[model samples]
Target: MTTGRGLRGTAAVVGIGNPRYHKRGTSEDSALALILKAILAACEDAGADPRGIDGFVSYANDLNEGLAVGAALGVREVRWSTMVWGGGGGGVAAAVNAAAAAVATGQAECVAVYRGITEADDGRQSYGKGHFPPLLTAHGIVTPAQICALRTQRMLEADGVPRSAMEALTAVSYLHAQSNPDAAAFGKPLDPEVYADSRWIAEPLRLYDCSRENDGAGALLVVPAERARDFAQPPAYVLSGVQGAGPDWSESLENDAAYTSAGFHPALVNRMWDGAGIKAGEVDVVQVYENFTGPAVASLIDVGLCPPGVAAGEFMTVDNLRAPGGGLPINTSGGNIADGFVHGIGLAVEAVRQIRGSSPNQVAGADVSLLLGGPMAPLVSATIFGSAATR
Candidate 1:
């Protein structure tokens, strides 16, 4: 049942920009400055005047307020300004959804969806201090790695998924990163032996399995679909952007089903594919957020890209996940694991690049690119981007 409605094809991403990426705590610029730079670069990429942008959307409790950013950019006016609630990368796609909705509804003509981060020693790590419920934190499930490990452990032990799949995911991301000059791991390469010997951050999750925190900002411009071709680059149509969590996902660990899953409810996945008027098999590339590799494996299963249980052993090979000739090239810009993790917003920019045929590890003849947001959070999201031919 193809829904074919909603914000599908009503708006398109005309431009994408990332000012620069820096190692965490090494950025000389403030978070706000990085954001402004990214937005201006996006405007330049689209050949759109910064003054024309009237809407802003962001996620992860971004400190840079929209109006403040607008003032910095010297925009004409601030028409719509909003941020998705919650933390982590769960809202990456949701932010894009909000921007597309604004453009589709005429709430704003040109909307910028952006995220910037400059990790301080005191910040981000606070997630382990006060974010979780007392019940879990008391048991030492404070860090995201500890919390997500329980879920991945279940998938590996009870569900019969092999640990090799997770290792392959890590290796493949690093493989793609070697081709992406902007990736933080650009010159670094990871092999099976290196991954196997890496220290364990959590049981079933090695140090290399986790994402690297970086200080950077990424931005993209969205406009009405009809006007997309006027931009400096080819448009990547917003086929669908859906966000929500599965049943009993509130506590992240209380429910057995929810605990083992990636939070992409079956219904939510169905709705996204139906609304896009495309099937999972139609996606030419993918950008699954890798806050950690285990949840990413669960995400692949939940989204119907990889079958449940030990089937992932066969599907998640490094050869099958790499670009150019891979069955489903993923994280073509290296993803959160190998690329700089700018709150997962960089994944969305990579999706747009795949559609525009501008990805550093460009997937040949790619038309549809999918982005799966952070898994196992309070809220999760998925988005699909298509070339103009798909629209």
Candidate 2:
């Protein structure tokens, strides 16, 4: 149960599975079905039987499915089952929590973490309730896009972030999406002109600035590091993980500019780097949450992966993220904006792929990856991953 800056005794991710994405199909696929499918595949990949699972983790009130999904996954015994209370980005925290809990307590040898969500016709309604605090609801901060757009407009004015910056990032995401087979908006990539003229979802945020609502599921199987060599995929050891929460929704506190940035706490970024025993420069690939383009750019700067205010110029370059030999290869599997928002679950799976050299637009010799989990209700999670033996 020893834990420290290094992953000396931490659990490792042994298998990852994502059920096939059906862009337009509305057949009888339920959240439980998708969850089971992903779990079965992940277990098979890890060479572990479902009955061996003793721990489970998922969202508290995930819209796609109910809380009963954990027990229904066929785990013969249960040591722990609890939901991490955050928004879309809670998925990564769930995995980290499960792994840490399993390693700390003598509860289980194997832990299965899974997330399944669907963008069916009724999916849009899921966001309208329970996601925000009383103040946000009272102040009419309804849809997530509107809430983020307000922040983006303020950043645009204060930081002088331009329309071109938005267009460039969104357009690059679309281009990457077009290259991904699982992307919901694959053939619907948008151009700058089209993006500029598109109807606004909220001021300063056009239709293209938001992530696609997608229906998909992702799962990760973790086992004690000592047993990782017997699993399926070359394990991606969890080097470090940290989660942080911001101030409450009070008038001056939540809206204060200085404290506003605190909500997304750059502190977690430092902790992630410190815990991994590596600076941001050592990161080979980055899987940033793309709920909105502004936060995606802001995360790099906040995390010290890029110099302050230079993310738009350095990493946002189309040639940089997609070039044959670019400086930084980001979201090569198409980020959340392009890869289908499996609610940050897709990002973790993508990170594992990059480290394993299985990604479609794989970065050359990428043995390390950085994954960020959200623009949640003032909570953020960051984690570092590397080959299991490194643990």
Candidate 3:
């Protein structure tokens, strides 16, 4: 097998794009328009023509955008197209799909992936239609905050993880966002009491405990590693990528309580590390899905990237120095918590920027980045990147 911190195959992210994270305009742009804007900018960033895109990937929630978004973006010759099934964990799924297609078929020289959300006006709840079980909606589990909060409570109670641990992570996200000009939560610093007393969406989840529902769009351009250098500024090479699903629905496989197999996302992480020829400890940066702060900590422990049960204490502390530009920067772009959830695409766009050192809140000297998506009620994905090394 290949050895050391190098990629196994050939794929690289050559471009990245995003509209402002907060409300971009008063006109309330449609999801299709948001995605198109991001895609065109991504293509320009990659120095590729929009019409030249041979592959495309988008949120399976495309129907939420009222259909035909992919075609409208002009993917008329699409040889590869896919939609991820897992809830809010489709970012890494999209990347994994594109990279795998590029490596295997050798047909698509470039791929464009986009995700966008146009938040409903205040009268409507953000979680509307498709995918979630009727039981969840009928019983009023209509918001992700409630469901994700239950997982957070279970982890804290069963794992003895302190509340301060969660607060620390929340605080760091706010701090990072304050520095990120493109973030929705820009300049908003969340304090301990603010977290402790914010409106309770669920038992342990307060208003600040959840990710903000905001309008935004993000896109990434992927090209074969051999051609990455000619595409964009300081490409981020794809070292490895993997996807997985856990047990049945009743098992509630999103949490440790439901696990009958190996450590949740570790199965996928192992496959990725094996493919990338890098050890878990060697990862320089991580951009894990954080629908809730608890899952963020859970992911680190499950992936073998941190000592068991210590992710909360070690990674989330204000004194710990794991924030952006810190020792082991976790989410330099504020993550879902502060950057605003553009589904999972915000995380992917931030990973690309971190690797490029172009992030508004750049993590200094980030040579390696690990991006993950999930809690996907058992579904998950992991992707690794090294600093444009393949070309």
Query: By TM-score, who's the top model here?
Result: 1
Tens digit per residue, CA lDDT, model 1, 299-320: 9999999988889989999999
Clashing pairs in 1: none
- Lowest lDDT sum, 10 consecutive residues, model 2, at 246-255
Residue lDDT tens for model 3, 31-135: 667778888888888887887777767653544331255577665577666666555664455455554456445767777777776754322233333445666
TM accuracy, model 1: 0.96
Position 333, candidate 3: lDDT: 76
- What is the Cα root-mean-square deviation between model 2 and the actual structure? 3.0
Model 2, 1-391: lDDT tens digits are: 3355344357778888886665533636876678778888888877888878777766535643323554676567777665666566634654665565575466677777777766553365343346666777788777777677776776667765555555666766677767777776678777667877888888877777777666667888777777778876788777777776744422232464542142446565666767777777788888877777766766665676644443456556777666226667677667777777667777888888887877767778776787877653455677788764344
User: CA RMSD for every model?
Assistant: 1.8, 3.0, 3.7
lDDT values for all models = 0.86, 0.67, 0.67
Backbone clash count for every predicted candidate, in the order shown: 0, 0, 0
RMSD of 1: 1.8
Off by over 4 Å in 3: 1-7, 24-27, 64-76, 120-131, 134-140, 248-263, 321-325, 376-378, 389-391
